[model samples]
Target: MPIIDKEGNFLAVADNVETISNSAAIADVMAQFANAEILGIIFPTHHDGRGYSLTKKLRRAGFNGKLRAIGPLIPDQFSDLIACGFDEIEISDEQFLRQPLVQWLAAKEISQHSYQNNNSTKTSIFQSRRQKIAANRHLNLVRELP
Candidate 1:
């Protein structure tokens, strides 16, 4: 399996990674890997969404360590995986060849303007609109200052 970071850069797989099953209880899994430096969540398949929720849960629980989503996830999921707090993705060699690094990078770029407020760096459509309005208001106020 090849590991890719949030920026779609290939990364050497870390050793001694404690990967937990997606089906396991969040609390139990957290308790087991609380002190782990790096953790992996086994996604099982492309259709499994539990991994996303699990990532969010882990982040909310204050697990500030690195997280990897391991499975056959598609390029389209790259952005959401990061938004869900996953630092890296581990995919089979076949999946990597099929999707390629460019595909993963493109998918992430396409989702840069997503309307979700999940990722801090990526601004939502609502935030963009609010910013525009504020800027316009500020301009109007400036014009009136004359």
Candidate 2:
């Protein structure tokens, strides 16, 4: 079980999405939006990726709070992790021991383009991809019309 703050925010841990949904009061925090400050989504294990969806859901729900990934995530997944909307990641002690601060910094250098690139000089792949998809869909619809 996770704790829900009086302000209505709670951790979006991998196994806790259901609980959050079931509790109307807790879920209302996200709807209200103003009260949320930090939202934590747990990854549980290195292989589990449910946190990504949780982050996405929070973003789509208009939660501009500090979204954090709390688990034993490796630096290699930082790109996707960030693109999924996490402001920071918190790993377990064992993972920190396995990959030091230097390694994590190096991971940041591995990618210059995330799908949701926010760097001022770069455009998000999502924007370009959306344009192409819409164009393609229009073409298909035109071809089918006559």
Candidate 3:
């Protein structure tokens, strides 16, 4: 659902910082990102992927304040969005009507693993399988050694 409503149920606090540029120095916002009560990144369109990269960068930079994604995004990307450190997603009414909450929730479970170095969830099938194989091998060695 949209983050904000006509009645004002859910909302994001606007930052007082003046200039926020994609290519600007993120160091400039270290203090603001830390001190601000709320912070967010807006994706003008689905094609613009700066938000995804920026979200990870902000979180890593220690922006513990509220992080929200404001744009029209597909339900399938919800998990990645959250994993990248988004607390909530703000989409248009038309987007909500088409996908709805159920669709988003379902999309959240689309993948159990992420190939990205930094993400919300840590469930990678390849990594998981490797760990299991190592554990099983260790167990077999112990059983034979005694």
Candidate 4:
């Protein structure tokens, strides 16, 4: 995932995302949401309350991924974000890397529930494809391990 700084410049691209300390223009940032390889957003401190509103809009606009609060975000705001559809969080670099595993587990759990619920045929098909990819990767890892 790549992080963009406040000036709309590329900051870093890695398997994980880190804190974005710079303030970005919310409109421009949200425009990147559809095409950005970014897995999350990190709202910096000292800006207007645009970041929270941006995240809420992103979720409403169909961003089905992580939405993180980087600087000056208190724990009390977690539930609010969750209510708005923010999934994973990145409190630190370590937490960011670990988030993929958490997401994988969550996906697996949700897939199970979805199978039981029998709703959203499209989602079931997508989840089956995702599970197949995961299983294939696991088999590759196991093959490489020994």
The candidate maximizing TM-score is 1
Q: In order, how many clashes per candidate?
A: 0, 0, 2, 0
Candidate 2 lDDT, tens digit per residue, 11-98? Answer: 3354322223211243565655435565566676867877777666667776776766666777787666766776666666666767
Q: Which 10 consecutive residues of model 1 have the lowest summed lDDT?
A: 111-120
Whole-structure CA lDDT of model 3:
0.66
Worst 10 contiguous positions by lDDT, candidate 3: 4-13
- Summarize candidate 1's per-residue lDDT along 21-140 as a digit string, tens digits: 987787897788888888999988889899989888888988888999999999899889999899999998888889889999888888778778884478889889999999999999
| Deviation (Å) of 85 in candidate 1 | 0.9
State the displacement of the C-alpha of residue 100, model 1, in Å, after optimal TM-score superposition.
Answer: 1.7
Question: What is each predicted model's overall lDDT from 0 to 1?
Answer: 0.87, 0.60, 0.66, 0.47
Ranking by lDDT: 1, 3, 2, 4
Model 2: clashing residue pairs? none
Error of 4 at 36 (Å): 4.3
How far residue 89's Cα lies from its native spot in candidate 3, in Å, is 0.7
Which stretches of candidate 3 lie above 4 Å from their native place?
A: 4-24
Clashing pairs in 3: 83-120, 113-123
Worst 10 residues of 4 by lDDT: 113-122
lDDT per residue for candidate 3 within 50-114, as digits (tens), equals 88777778888877777667777777777777777777767888987887776776666556567
Per-model root-mean-square deviation over C-alphas: 1.4, 10.6, 4.8, 13.6
Model 4 RMSD in Å is 13.6
lDDT of 4: 0.47
C-alpha lDDT of residue 132 in model 3: 97
**lDDT of model 2 at position 47:** 78
